[model samples]
Target: MDRPLRLIYCVFGLVTFCQASIIPCKDDDTKCLVSTANDIYPKIMSGDASIGAEILDPVWIDEIDGSVTILKYKFERCTVAGYKKCNITSLRIDAHNSKLKLNLMCPEVNLSGFYDINGRLIILPVQGNGNFSIDAYSYNINIDATYKIVKTDDRKEYITIKNFNFDANAEKGAKFQFDNLFNGRKDLADSVLKFANENSKEVLQEFQRPILSITYKIFIKNIYKFLKAMPMDNIFKQIYPKLHSFTCVRASLTPPTPCKADDTNCMMTIGKSVYKQVLTGDKSIGAERLEPMKFDEIDGGLTMLKFKMTDTTISGYEKCDMKDLKHDNAKMSFAMKITCPHLEVVGTYDMDGRLIVLPVQGKGKFSIIMDSYDLSLTVTYKIVKDDGGKEHLSIKTYQAEAEPIKGVKYEFQNLFNGKQDLANSVHKFANENWKEVTLQFQGPIIAATFKKLIKNTNKFLKAMPMDKVFL
Candidate 1:
């Protein structure tokens, strides 16, 4: 749906919520713009989805001289979904005819966005009946009306009605649909992957940077201009960027337990709001020593990261949910064991800084060092999807020596061992299978999409937080 951006313009301040938003109604009831409650009772019992009803009209007594003028009366269901994942893919060997079940849920889901501070923001994850209530795919949506423009006189305050949750069942449903159709044919891999894209979209964990950086850069660049014009700090105040959901938690290859079904080494899960501390560094400094995930997958969760090439290697397991983005960000224990001293992490990453974000879009930028100087990589994210699904972040690094003052040439041991390095293999594959590696996004689209993805990450970053996100 191509919709224009319309906003409820006003100053930001504490506004009391009115009673018009608290009335309960069926999912299919409608038609309450006017008329008495008894007059609308017949329509309410008729099971109509179009007839509107005013939920706030009962207690909403506003006389024109000594009354309330309600403006911008609106309603919507709010939802919230988690926005973090791992850099690995579940390498599950499905049993023949096995029915796979993934009833995952987003941190937030299906909720309201446009709302009134006066009305009640009733939220329902999914429309259902009772204790055994299951979501009725075919149901109606009802809302109370009183803050309409016809009643507006002076109040401009408003509340937001929104829902942003990751629907795990919906996501798993998509995967299952395809699993049922697959007959174990390699030729069908494309279709399966395509389906994954159509349903789950980008698999990378840092799909918010591009949007954040662009927006942040724009803000910094224009803040002086705005400050030159306006004086109030509130004028410059914007929605602060927040680190939402993170579910990339993967299991450890070797933890305190056997790591099987009974393993108790999983990450300790957080219930509600969690305050996690993280450290910040640059390409010059990296984790000199790192190990695999400290616990099991069931413990809590892993931070989903699609690192390009960092100078440092944090030990952890690679989750399977992050296998789609073309540029493999996997930190396989084997790979880390091999390229320990050769890589570099360059660029900027969110080490935890509060930022003002826009309502619809924002971005964040991050850079990391491998361990020593040399390996440098930048992770970026934005508020929109422009990059197809791949990143051109790979930079070829060759061990070079510094110039000697005299005739002596300093020599250092080559960290790389094999002539046929994985870097070379990856390059070869890209050159040959560029179509598959890059997919439909081409080069331009790739930049457009990811420019916003990685930026919105790291808001809730933790220090050396559970490294096992390799997929």
Candidate 2:
């Protein structure tokens, strides 16, 4: 009886010790991350019931709609296989920024589903309603994700994804098969499928975005379940530690390049470095994070043309190029010309009145992309003495001017009470007349953006002495 009781106790302890099978990875340990992922990939692919993880080998998607130039297609009740056999080729974890990237490659991925297709696939007319299958050979996927840690009411920590992006590629291309084409006429179906398979690369490229969009959704859902069940510390042996103010005060500061009061070139170089650091939320020098900059709301447009945007998130500012920099020691001021490849603004909007010539009214989600976004900024500052008699730069005035060089793209969902045709027409008109749209809209937008920049710069400068920045 004593021996049996001891044996039972040992079994219980073993089960408790094996609660998490994944080997933990230290912060930013790429090798460990890859090894751990590889070790657990099979279990995750097969669905780990303990973690409530779903089987990913046959990832399911209810529906997907996509268009390429003139080609439009839809797939329903899709199931994709071969994920179970995928290998993690690379893994990069930037735990400091809560960002992770991993590469997955498989010999082949098979997709089977019901399809309704209409449109020109290259020169061939593709119109069909039946079953379909695609064999993508040498399939590869690159995934990038941003995540945040959430604490439950019971004080348990979990990782939740904030943003996710991915793209798919197949080196050996793909083969497509569509059944019951042209009312079960086999000849026409064979010809189209043959042509598509011959030019598989191009055909697959056309549908990649839509296909991957579904892939991202399903992939995130499963990964989220796995991550939620595993605590942050369990997945990562260590989380990147934040720098405290006391430590930062004693740390050595190195300029990107040597800088002087009137050196515009050096200033530009340093400005670029500082901008990047601030964007990443470097607390070492008291710089505030600007990535995914959020605004509760911004009100603008003509008095009659009242436009309000809420829960706004601005991104793509990191792609900015400092075209020109000017520093004036006499006035303690600086002027800069910064151009970004694009600036993306996403938010919910409430608008009433005329946008240029068209009368527009809506309250819905909006996404605007400003291409070749040129911004000019002029900042004037004055030296202020702190309690310790240390001098710091205080912003006196901030000014900004902006222009969209290439043009702007607008997507407003649920616009005009879900008037699809009307909203699409409005989008076309706005895109065509983007200059007028920018002219009417850029002022308040640029002002609000620069306002945040000024606030962040002041915060950093307040922590830094005037001599430190100039010298």
Candidate 3:
């Protein structure tokens, strides 16, 4: 079939296939919008792998970190359930103005994760890391978004959300439970839990921003995927002849040549090319801009040190050099090392307790200039045959390590809460002990920094064949 005919057939087939759940609606048809949402919510949340829409309910979140006036918290490996139970209480769609709003309510919702917390909570010190559970009754969520129609170079049109806001509230408040608080001290843990439950409403209000921010990300991502597959113009109407499925777009890199199995130097050169593309982000290849990498929050700690770093930005990656590359073809693994002469990290930090017996308590802006920083990464992948019978590399997992070879300089503003002399003394002392401080906390920082690196690498590799990338 020709392109036009195939598209027509697809539209006809889709209408026939989804007629029970979906139908054409006018731009201002509020009843149609709500009815259609209720009908197709289950299918959408169940996910359609063909369109690259991953499962939305029981959503998996890798990490979430945020801070309020006095409390900082981090959650990892979180699973949020109950969105599937939500009902669209109200909805607004103004296609003429490129705006959308949705109001959802769920009778009950639950979240479980590993959490790390620091700072003060209602006149009590809150610090710990362990399993956590939060249950909210009669949860409500409101989403508002405005998007622009973007026409891609391929002449395909998609909706790019310009502004998004997500708000969450609970009718019956929430309950919080955290295990292993204060190193599993039953007495203190009981007291803290009791107090938290009593003040759950206020506490939830304070932490709602970060939590809802992540939920917003999840919803927006799915919306983007759905809109991309079914363009904005075709979303509410029966005509979808131009609908296109989502797929990874590969970067335009130097042509590949077959390399000998033991040619490590050639591998290093190819690795450099991949890194450049991944680091710089090529829109042509669907890579997001990463020149000045940014992270909203990162939290981790040692025995005595608990810290939160927020609004962090790191630059100077373009000047990095690939030091070494090694491959184990039989084992399907690769290890590489890179060194950068300088990297500047700027962020605000909230820290408490001591590091190596040095008092370190602060909440303010911080700057760290790392000299001769080396990063090493080990990646293991498996080759899988796609539906088309072409082999692609699927990254199983990756490990990253960073070390500052020469030294590091640190400057923090507002230490000791703006005591000039005390802040200066602490800064001097910290600069002298930079290595120890970094050693205690750099593990998580480095991991957070390289998360995008690994993700982009995998993305780049996923769009190509193993032979194309390595051989």
Candidate 4:
């Protein structure tokens, strides 16, 4: 019996001894991040496939207030065929029990179009409150226009609006009034002009602006719908593999440029907004800095507005400091910096949902060197297989090895469970067995605290619903 216990202990002890022989290789910060990210990618992707399939991802009409709902969308990375890359990251809605369930797995691309890759769709659980603007715009536009669109929809050849068609009138005075206004009397024109001059602002205000009300009857094509209507030939052939620059405000547009390999011109995205192809100047590998502005408060806190480049992810907002574009063909100047924030809750394929983004390193690198080895317990977590058919997220406990780094022969301690026995296996191995793994970094630490990079990354992932594991 002692032999058996000795043998079992020997097996465990010898393994621990082997672990003590770790010889590390030095690597830079990028390598450190890539290694860590690659190490976790499989788990993240698997979770996306399994857990994301279970959540809800749609919004329905019956859930609206007074048969209507209004929404306001701030624009971000778009410049492709006049579309902005935006993901609906949050919904501030006001209604009675108004819940907008956005399918996070929805096939959407950066203001360009959607593909099946990002996930089936994202379904969101909306909380808090604000009136939706979709209904309000619809209401305002439907009323108060002499040329209000009767059939603004495209199924017909022309936009039929409520026109003031003088041609349709048979009244004798109407024709005389037209002749007087157009050809006959300068005095009559001056009198009418004076009346308009007095009331013009009010008329324009009524036509230009109305009560921002919500209406149910109007159905205008939204940006997403408009993009979806592009012929597949157009989307895949003309749009894909090309890059564009867009301004989130006004009529800023950058035409698509051909994409090349080897440069940062590789596939990159702004938030959930996708764009491809970029011109690499004489230098082929530097990513253009993206300078999209970011807000400190709000869900889905980042926006992207630059075109694609080689190895960098940049965000941009129009330079408040620069002069405006002078002409149509002029190359608009933009200022870019590293940007785009991950969203918390609220899901839709807007700029915030774009997958390939530049990563942030917080303080970049930090360190934690121990003169003695002590395995920490309590604050540990491990990837676990749960009953939801998806992986179970479980707590792991670590016990310090209990020996000083200098004096005694060192040993390794593990925090793992038998049932949730993954032990970082899938990340380290194809099979379920864990491997003798090692890591190297540009320095011993990353970000301000040695643990901060990982901590911030985890915070980003954790803020997202379990279904939305990073893509």
Best prediction by TM-score:
3
* TM-score of each predicted structure versus truth: 0.15, 0.45, 0.47, 0.15
Residue-level lDDT tens digits of model 3 in 67-160: 7779888987677888899898876766556667778899988888789998887677878899999988898888887767678877765555
Backbone atom clashes (below 3 Å) for every candidate: 148, 0, 0, 74
Candidate 4 per-residue lDDT, tens place, 1-471, comes to 121121211111211111221122222223432333333222211111101110011111212121112211221211121011112222121112221111111122111111111111012111112221111111111112121112224432212123211101111111101113324356744554354334543322321111112111111112112222222221111111211322110012232232222223222222112111111111122322123212222122212211111121212222111111111111111112222122111111111122122111111111112222221111223333435555322222111111122221111112132222432332233111111111111011111111322232233323222232212
- Between candidates 1 and 2, which one is better according to TM-score? 2
Quantify all predictions' global Cα lDDT against the true fold.
Answer: 0.20, 0.68, 0.68, 0.20
lDDT of 3 at 100: 72
Q: How close is candidate 2 to the true structure, as a TM-score?
A: 0.45
Sort by TM-score, best first. 3, 2, 1, 4
Give a tens-digit lDDT track for model 1, residues 412-447.
111123234532543344344433322211122122
Q: Candidate 2 residues 1-471, lDDT tens each?
A: 122222211111111121323344455466876776676566555443323344466665657888668888888767787888889888776645666677999999998878998889888987889998999999888988776667888776665678888888888999888887777778888888889999998888877788888776766666675555444333323322221111011112553444555566666777776666656655765655788788998877432257888999999998888888877654445678988998899999998775654667789889998888888776655667899998776765554557689989988787789888878888888999998677666556666777777777777767776555544
Deviation in Å, model 4, residue 162 alpha carbon = 22
| lDDT value, residue 310 of candidate 1 | 17
Instruction: Give the per-residue Cα lDDT of candidate 3 at 184.
Output: 88
Q: What RMSD, rounded to one decimal, does every model reach?
A: 28.8, 20.9, 15.4, 31.6
